[model samples]
Target: MAEIIGVIEQLWRYPVKSTGGERLDSVEVDERGLAGDRLYAVRDSAGKLGSGKNTRRFRRMDGLLRLSSRLGHRLDGPELFDPLGRPVADPTAFLRAYLQRPDVALAREDAVSHFDQLPVSVLTTATLDWVRGAAPAAVVDVRRFRPNILLRTPPGTPPFVEDGWFGREGGGGARLAFVRASERCAMTTVAQPGLPHAPEILKAIIQAHEGRLDALAEVVTPGRLSVGDELSLN
Candidate 1:
């Protein structure tokens, strides 16, 4: 028997990795997760993808969060936009100039995945409220966490409630299994449009939750998901 838990309150798609994303009323979920999410990324001449942290596969690239991307009608790929919502004519040139890295360029994800870990990320309003209580002065916007789906739990739900859903399959139009708790990073503190740089946010998460905030999920079935769609646990 399945039990109703919450409804989809928000949906987000990141056309480009490590950049600001667009919110949607509805979205298509595929095996790779959201259809257009992280389809493109900023790559350097060394073949390392740009990210907030430096790893073997990702290079620390500042200012990526300041930019935003959206899927273009042409279907070629995503189009990059400036922080002010201006379209970038030549993304490679603009990025090279803005980042001051002459060897950097925008590229599509190929054999390597653009995602940092699991494809889909999930969060709940209860978790957000908890974080706000932990860091009273910091902004607790969902954009800071960059989740693909934001679940609105019923009133009186406690923080970190999604942790119990791990390994459980659920969704209304699509099926998703929560795999693990999402780890917080410095990117959560990065200042983007309408968000301020607040390192205290990450500090709070680390102290309270061992640096984990939300849930990372895998798509079990592909389908369309919309706002207000009920989510259940099976």
Candidate 2:
């Protein structure tokens, strides 16, 4: 029998890579992961992927942090929203002005999602609480972590319990196997909207949790995932 672990607290979909994502009440999950998640990416002059993390050719592009998008025409791709949450027809020009990079362009993902590692990621409330406890002075919001699913673990469940869910099945038929603990980066420390720039927040993660606050998951069984759905370990 499967044991009840937690309820899905929030659902998010990033239609464009390395940009602010939007919350959803419920979502469809396919093999590639959430529908309309990371289907678009910012391409630089040299055609390098513009990632939030400052990793090599994937330059750190924080300007996109204040922006978001929604699924527009299936053939045309996502329609981007401005920093003020207003939709813009020409996303490339809008983003260029925001990032001050005229050479950059918004392009659709070729064959797969532009996910950093795995297509899906989950973060437990317990883990967020740990970060807050570790850095009480800094604001702790789920947006910093950018997880596809935010789970509210049962009360009294210890933090980092997600680490143990590796190689487990959850809900009705969605099987998840942890690729590895997600590595923290400077992106989490960046300020965006309600979040403040707090370098110590990432420091605490490194000191206490080895710089990982969430876990990446790969779907073995495709199914619908919702805000109230309960997760279980198989």
Best by TM-score: 1
Candidate 2's TM-score reads 0.93
Misplaced by over 4 Å in model 2 are 72-76, 111-113
Question: Who wins the lDDT comparison?
Answer: 1
lDDT accuracy of residue 146 in candidate 1: 96
Each candidate structure's TM-score, on Cα atoms with residue i matched to residue i, is 0.97, 0.93
Q: Give the per-residue lDDT digits (tens) of candidate 1, residues 134-218.
A: 8889877999999999999999999999899997998889999888998889999999999899999999889888999788989
Q: In model 1, how many backbone clashes occur?
A: 0
Full-model lDDT for every candidate: 0.91, 0.81
C-alpha positional error of residue 197 in candidate 1 after TM-score superposition, expressed in Å: 1.0
Least accurate 10 contiguous residues by lDDT in model 2: 169-178
